[model samples]
Target: LAPQPKAPPSPPAPQALELPPNASPVLSSGPSPPPAPKASQPPPSGPSPPTAPKAAPPPPPPSKSGGPLPPPPALPGSSKTRPPPLMKSGNKTDTDEDSSEAKTKLKPFFWDKVATNANKSMVWDHLKAGSFQLSEDAIETLFGCNADKKSGDAKKDIASKEAAQVVRILDPKKAQNLAISLKALSVSAEEVSCAVKEGNELPSDLIQTLIRWVPSTDEELRLRLYTGELSQLGPAEQFLKAIFDIPYIYERLDALLFMAGLPEETSNVKQSFATLEMACEELKNSRLFLKLLEAVLKTGNRMNVGTFRGGAQAFKLDTLLKLSDVKGTDGKITLLHFVVQEMIHSEGVRSARAAKEQTGSVSSVDNNDLIEEEYKQLGLQAVSSLGDELQNVRNAAILDADQLAMSVASVVHRLGKTKEFLNTSMKSLDEDSGFHRKLVHFVEQSQTDVTFLLEEEKKIRSLVKSTVDYFHGRTGKDEGLRLFVVVRDFLAMLDKVCNEVKEASKVTPKKTKTEFPHTQVFSRSPA
Candidate 1:
């Protein structure tokens, strides 16, 4: 068999650190990436004598891509001084290639020693595992006032205790420094809780700072922790628990949920108001319905001409409901039936003539067709139609405007109450301070958002009351539900009657050319 080349010598074994069992590196044994540029510089390349490969450390498991992991990175401040280049036979040309090879051979040993030292320093454990404990000096700096005092239960006692204990423990400047260090070390929430418990009361500044620094203490976690009444807590945890205890916190939460629905509520009101305005405008201004009403009034007058009810000056809108109650002598059809028949016949006469005059041909006019053409001209077709527009109005009208207004007003009131409580109880949150400034900005913005549609709402409010009064109804603090029902039923009945008239007209026969000779005369005379 052909001779096989011996396997290349292994890379050097890395030096290991001596650590307590519990304090060993928490970082993964797999190789890490290169250290930052500022920590280490790459070595210069040159040639030197060839050297055997240094021994390699235990190989990392094959990566997902089927290669071994790279070596762990050198730590910051762990780089070694580069030695002078090696020479071979005192010739520059011969030494150039060999120098590069020798440099590669020696590099692993130096890096192994540097990495071992870095692991011994335990900085990696602190940064990677977030296991850094508060030093004695840091603890002393935070709570080092050498005195103890007792607090009383009465008003004076509470004041004295808060003044002595809470104030001294929460020095703003020291707390800020501590927060900076904790952030740098990537301290865990448990560590933060422990640190806070060591100090009795949390300063408003600290609370504000920590909220930004530690976003992990989310609303859900805060609620879960605060809701548990039997759990033992540190002073910091207790302070956090107390902050949540503020009644306004619950109020604020409820307000947020309510605010979520405000957009849809506001949209419904605006759209409903627009629809009602359109429908009412058509009812007030359309001439077709007016003419129809006049015909009905004439019928009523003729019916009661010899009676005491004859020649009425004006009739209430409620009179429309009584038309069905007034039956003919046959008792099979009511006054409403006669009225609808008259309206449909009128539509046929007027529309057939107009069609002959416009088209100059009686053959083009179908007297049996519904008065849809006249309806279009009088704008009554759109008024009688009910779809999303009617629904929009109903949705708006059914809303408890007073309740919505009260809910919004309540939130505004609570904001003011919270501001007062904060000012009176925590006097430490100075008006000019960052926390106070941010808080004021928030309140102002909230008030603006809550009251954005107030003016439009006021106009709609008055309009709604007027609508009720117009219908001879009243809705005292009921958000117009009764008023809306009346309007809804009235419009629905009108639509049904209009539909009936149209359907009845469809079965009526067409006016033939022989029946109307006026169209032939007009067509011949026209230029």
Candidate 2:
């Protein structure tokens, strides 16, 4: 019996990174096709060395043979095809072969096109297995050079081996171009991020950089870092716990927007879903947001103060209010609106707190130039963005507040329209079918929730007051009382509206169902 050649060892297991569902199936580090063995300075008559086998050519297109077919839409991954490999200066014989065989030369653009359309998994697996030099050369010539090869001094590299070289360039611009040629390509920095513990293979320097980046205080970097860090976290409760423990405004904001579904932008569009997952993890961490949400869930409290900006001692008024703005069960949007409103209102409170915190303590304030310079860095006018930024958080917080409030308001307005639709009461269950009665019940419950949300949003700032507006640093009590009276009267009007709605719905007969007035008010419909 003939002896069989031993198969190379299987590739190493994939690292522990949580790859996306559509991540490439190809594994790297397989046996590469070795470079051709050279006999130095061969004469023209000497025999050429045997070349390695080229990859399997693709099947001819059925659509092309039959008739005109629509071009495929651009792939979702990046459009960057890899740049061509540099023609090595040392290989003179390579140039001679190309100059000699201009008649039979394959267009370099053909290889470029193949590189863009080929499956990345196929290329990744082939290069990873072994010494892939020959394949790499083929790939480089194909992707890097052009169809008008005879015009350029392209050293006449052989057409057969261009696929492999295209796979190895790590630069994103080059990589992105190379990726455009393949079936699907993704460009991600290989960051070794970990909150705790370390892994192997990755150099220690890379690991350290990742650690420093993971806990960034800067909202921009933290928001960017949150995506990579959360991917390392895997799908478990513990991973979320670790992220929330760290405090940064962008981290918190990203988490909030993500958990709410309208994820904020940071990286490439392909990774937006990853952004959403991280957002969910962030919402899990916000104690203030979560606690207030629990209260809303319990009493359906719309007018609750939500979380305070600088705690309750900051509020001059004595009570919270309740209101509803939508017909949904969960009050996420309404709650966000209130939270933003409070954040906006609380800026003055926080500024007051900043002043009060420094009241008794004496520090040098003579360095106005130094303070103004610092404010410039924070991008502010007059006052140190620092003083206000203890609220601009570099404008990230304010921007988030604006975005979150807008989204919530859009949703709340949608609920208001649905309320208008079901204005008439339902007929008796006996007259209509049981299904009709169930429908009415669902609408009634939804309307109550909506009413509650509207009420809650309307009343968000009802009890909030600046602890120090103008002071000894003590402001006058009559002024405080005067402010409280204005709020008291407004709350009474809101309560009256709520009571009137409940009464009208109770005694009213069933009306015909109509189209929701605001059309999209049901955006976050019920679930």
Cα distance off (Å), candidate 1, residue 156: 52
Over 316-432, each residue of candidate 2 has an lDDT whose tens digit, in order, gives 322224333442355443433333222222232334334545796455322222232232222212111222212211122112323434555654564454334334322311334
lDDT of 1 by residue, 1-527 (tens): 99755555444433542343455344555555443333122332333323432322333344666454454544445676555455667665746778755532221223343344643756554575555675655554444433112212366786676555542222345445544644555544554344332322233344444544332335326544554442344333444344443333332332333334445555655555565555544444545555556656777777788999988655545576677687878886667766654554454455446657787665644445534445233333433443234554445445565675675566556656656655664355233433334445555665665565466556666776675555454534433545555445545665666676566546865443343222111111101
Off by over 4 Å in 2: 1-396, 399-409, 423-439, 462-527
Return the top candidate by TM-score. Answer: 1
The true-versus-predicted C-alpha distance at residue 41 of model 1, in Å, is 99
Q: What C-alpha lDDT values do all the predictions have?
A: 0.49, 0.33
**TM-scores, all models, native as reference:** 0.39, 0.16
For model 2 the TM-score comes to: 0.16
Error of 2 at 18 (Å): 99
Evaluate residue 515 in candidate 1 and report its C-alpha lDDT on the 0 to 100 scale: 39
